[model samples]
Target: MVAVTSSVPVTDPTLLDALRSDLRSADYTLDGVRSLLGPVAADALDREEALPARVVTASALASGADGRATLLRLFQLGEDVTRAALDAVLPTLRTAGAERLGLVATQGADDGDAVRAVVDLSPYAAVDAAGEVDWWIASDLGEVARRGALPENFVLGVGGASRTLAQITVREPRGSVLDVGTGCGIQALHASRHAGAVVATDIDARALAYARFNAALAGVRLDLREGSMLEPVLGETFDLVVSNPPFVITPRGEAGVGEFTYRDGGAVGDDVVRSLVTSVGSVLAPGGVAQLLGNWEHRRGEDWAERVGGWLTESGLDGWVVQREVQDPAQYAELWLRDGGITPDRDRARFEGAYAAWLADLDRRGVEGIGFGLVTLRRPALAGAAVSPWRRVEEITGTVAQPLGATIARVLDAVDLVRDLTSEALLGRRWQVAGDVTDERYFTPGEASPRVMLLRAGGGFARTVRTETGLAAFVGACDGELTGVQIVAALGTLLEVDAAALAAELEPQLRGLITDGLLLPAP
Candidate 1:
């Protein structure tokens, strides 16, 4: 592993206190920055386009802006600031203190004249089940700020994948939680809110250093360690584990291909993700859940579900995989290539070479496509509770609501509720359509009955199920007023069919709907 000797911020309590006070005084927060930059520039910055923000902040600086703008220009835009200006903005910490904290480096021989931020510090705000949080996170500067490719061991700030994992993670309070591959400690930081104790591990020392600094900045304690994957937490079980692992599949020993520690796990194909899925069960406490984001290969002639399901089968834990997106070989190649800051517009030769290498590497492995998704695994709370582990692999390639942790928890509970239920037992319980569920019927011209029926979920995976006449009637009658047996019998009588056969056909469907959160056990 590459060891990064880059400047990492120091965790000085007094300096941290001063910095926090100055940040609060300046109103340097998520909403504060957005309000200062306006919607257009803020949105552009979100897209990693820095020109709009540069222009706006330059204007603000020219007009003798406040401390927020000064800090924004220094940290977010990677601009050099006059030391005097920084001193005025951060009066409590001042220039000397910032230098001591390793947040900035003085330029030339004149220490009081000019300095620039060595780290990226920004405001973060989010509301999960635990409520609202506003904190400052510090990590290495990004590609846009650096104006070039990232180093192999570069510690990353909060990105799309991290944010997605945070939003989807089950957020119930727990005794112990673990964050594997805790880049910038974003996941660990989120876990700290509800968990009594959080242990975060990373293979990169610089990452751990950044995580340490971030934890200090946020005033949250984390047990930080340096190791790859589960090595740091072996033999110790956690109530919950969350990871945004380095699951990106990158080619090995190919010319013009470089490995980035932040994304590459140095494994062939998708072995990294496979290993994690199969082994994470060992670290999970009874009834503990592990949530991860990963990329899996779609090889030619091999079903993706079977391939991923094989991993779950080896795990001996209940597993659910939701594939949110699929990309063809070329699309995936270009995406990661550009992500590494090698763009066709910037360097055509290098881009084409690396792109060809990616295609060749994937073609060698018979990889036709790449799948990106979320993985949730749980160890059965009771020994011998399940004869076999339950596994569900599905594709939901549409927009879903954020803060999906609660929805996922409900789905897990529903799975357990129906896992051991017989058809008769399921029929004995009253069921109701979820509040987010609605049905639509399509009719042919002049037809008395609808030609097609659809059941749609307004939340969760935003799933839509096509329904036949019998199933439609059954679902329509599910008002919690009658048991499943009564509903199916009524539908059968109304449709002039055998009640037993109807029940047999709709039993699996009802279980599916319940697990997908379209139906619920009535109180």
Candidate 2:
């Protein structure tokens, strides 16, 4: 068996060292890039000492092409950003028939130097620069002459999901903030921009050290802990808990060539993500909020929303759950298998073994499929430990930091006012059944929904209205201007059914919709 260690040690020490030693290193500098349009805080890390540093890549600030290709194109944009400090490595990289050295993290990559000796100044630093980014700020350190972003594991960059978590996080001065699975401390770094105190935790020691170095260089204080979620912050509670946990459902005990310490969260299935969610509840003060990125099982009989909702239920808090993306078993399996697939000399045996292991683990645990994305929860204010659950389905993509804090505050302040809610249901009208929105599988106790729901077609705010036939008819009549009785009467007239019978049929669902915020009555 080949040697695969959990926490490998790096041999180098500074920024330039990592790059010059590699076959070819790369980073970028663009001339026309705009600076922050407003007055922004300068020099974020100033007081702390450098333990060691590495660039915790969030995403390739989107430049061109698609997926990975777009990332490489982004690299081409860095012209002057890179230091011509040594220019010695460029010739060697060229002679090696590879790209020039751009920027290098002081510590990362199996073959690269550990001490940061090379700076990844290549333009690819901002892989997905196209998304909603407030400002790309880096702590300027005099000790190291490099500035760039990339994972030590060399996994997916700060793509849409990473940026989403950054954007959704509430930025405010608080007593403390904990960034679990602090990949390169992007979220922690972001928190340091405002929070009074910051603590970041990661199972990967290298990652923890990088977070420490970055926080120090930025002149900020972030308590960096090297351990699993909550374990690092045990006996602690915070005003805010944010994490981009390693929710990738890699097969159990599966390790490969490039599955860097950066992304993998390490719980068999949805366990890691769920653990993060549940733990945040325990560590957050009442009224404190926890925002996390995760992946969960889209089990045969379970409702994804409800499954996530249940985490909130037992947590003694108020919760908001949103399933941003879902992937089928095959598609989900292939993406991760391929992630491990890209490493050097990776073959079918390794890939298939990893994939099969993942399947088997899920099968043993009774997990039907895997789903990934973001979820946010707010610990309840009341002391009885009863959970006040509120849910919504929102794109929230294209928004800024303001919405996250504001929306959560709004929800909490008006938590008593809103009902069982589904944004897709309340935002539009005239939704169709059978064709408009449908589920893949259902639980029957009949008979609920199933594995996945198909959105066959839609006109306005389309969603699989999770109500019965009678409830759908009743909801169609509620435009916030009708009472429950009035809605039932309207449905009764349209269906040529008795009003009393229709009311009786629709009451349970109507109550649920109102409770979940799907249907709002006339004020």
- Return the top candidate by TM-score: 1
Where is model 2 more than 4 Å wrong at Cα?
1-157, 216-219, 254-259, 301-306, 341-349, 364-366, 385-405, 416-523
What are the per-residue Cα lDDT tens digits for candidate 2 across 333-436?
A: 67655543332243666566656666666677667666665677876655465444555434322222223443444344545543333332333223122222
Root mean square deviation (Cα) for candidate 1: 2.6
The models' CA-based lDDT, in order, is 0.89, 0.49
Candidate 1 Cα misplacement greater than 4 A, ranges: 1-5, 108-112, 344-347
lDDT of 2 at 295: 79
* Weakest 10 consecutive residues of candidate 1 by summed lDDT: 1-10
Q: Can you list the residue pairs that collide in candidate 1?
A: none
Write down the TM-score for model 2. Answer: 0.56
Instruction: Residues 1-523, candidate 1: write the lDDT tens digits.
Output: 1112268899999999999999999999999999989999999999999999999888888898578889998888888888888888899999889989999887643535777888899999988888998989998887777777777777889889989999999998999999999989989988998999999999999899999999998999999999999998999999999999999899887765658888899999999999999999999999999999999999999999999999999999999999999999999998888778878787788789889999999999899999999999999888676457778899988899988999899888988888879889998899999998889999999999998899999987788999988878888888989998888878888889999999999989989998889988889
Clashes of 1: 0
- RMSD vs true structure, all candidates: 2.6, 12.8
Q: Tell me the number of clashing residue pairs for each predicted model.
A: 0, 85
